[model samples]
Every structure is written in C-alpha cells, then in structure tokens.
Target: MSLLDFLRRRGSAPVARERLQVLLAYERANRGYSDLLAVLREEIVAVIARHITIDRDCVAIKMDRGDTVSTLEIDIEIPHKAGALLVGT
Candidate 1:
C-alpha cells in the first residue's frame, strides 16, 4: 500500500472515544472532584513507587466532571514500561 493509504488506514482505526465519553460521564456524577483526584494521585504514586522510581513532579491526576458524572483522569509520567503498575496503583 502507498504511504498515504497506510497512514489513512491507521488513522481510520476505531478509537476508544466511547470509553472516554463514559468515563467523563462517570466523573461528573461523582462529588468531591478535587478530593477524589487527590486520592487517586496519591494512590497512583504509591503504586508506582512500589515498583520503580518515578518523577513525582511529572505525575498528574485530574478529574473531569461532566454534566452527570465524575471520571478519574490519571496522567502519569514514568520512565519505563510499567503499565502494569498502574493496575492497582
């Protein structure tokens, strides 16, 4: 396939837009958005630190509250492949 065709095909792949939308809805429904975010951040950092070293300054956790629910938005900055650490983190 041509480069353009390959790029287009890759871009056309189905995205997790629905999952994100659901998460947003869930977040909005939850109260205490900031408190929840703080708790999530602490948990995430604690979980990450258990396995590897992470730059605390780079760690970020946010809550996106939609019109109905609140969703936990976790943003982590790690230096290695430790995706599994985030499972319970």
Candidate 2:
C-alpha cells in the first residue's frame, strides 16, 4: 500500500474506534428499538428537509428512558452558507 493510504488509515483508527464505542452504547441502551429508531430518524429528516438544506448524515437522535419519563434528544447540524460568518469558531 502507498504511504498516503497507510497514513490515512492510521489517522482514522481513533475516529472509527470512537464511533464503534458509541454504537455499542446506543445498542445497549436502545435494545429492541432499532426498527423504530430508523423510521423515526427518516421521518424527522424528511420534515426538517422541507424547509432547509441540511446534511441528513449530520442528524443524531438519542432516547433516554427513566422510571417515569422518557426524553428524546435530537441534534441537527445546519450547514452554513458560502461566505457566511460563523459566530463561534
């Protein structure tokens, strides 16, 4: 393999590990809700897409269950327009 390819893979190992850890945690927490989560994510993305241009891959949804309450948390990353100044760097 080329040196560039080797370096690229080395650089991304940590990121891949982090993603895997998150997946494991989510799977453990959500258990049997995989199907429902997929559908819910799709629907939410569709609704949000009706108004703005967003990267679907940037959307994240997490559900937390408690004894008396369940909370659904959503995070959507809105892409900035070309030449737009961001408030926080």
Measured by lDDT, the strongest candidate is: 2
lDDT for 25 (candidate 2):
75
What is the lDDT for 48 in model 2?
79
TM-score of 1: 0.46
TM-score of each: 0.46, 0.52
Which tens-of-lDDT digit does each residue in 2-86 have in candidate 1?
9998888786535567667776666677746637657767888998788888888788776565667657667777765565565
Q: lDDT per model, in order?
A: 0.71, 0.80
In model 2, the number of clashes is 0
Stretches of candidate 1 off by over 4 Å are 1-34, 80-89
Which portions of model 2 miss their true places by more than 4 Å? 1-34, 82-89
- Name the candidate that leads on TM-score: 2
Candidate 2 residue pairs in clash (backbone atoms < 3 Å): none
- Find the 10 residues in a row with the least total lDDT in model 1: 80-89
**Residue 46 Cα positional deviation in candidate 1, in Å, after optimal superposition:** 0.6
Q: Residue 54: error of model 1 in Å?
A: 0.3
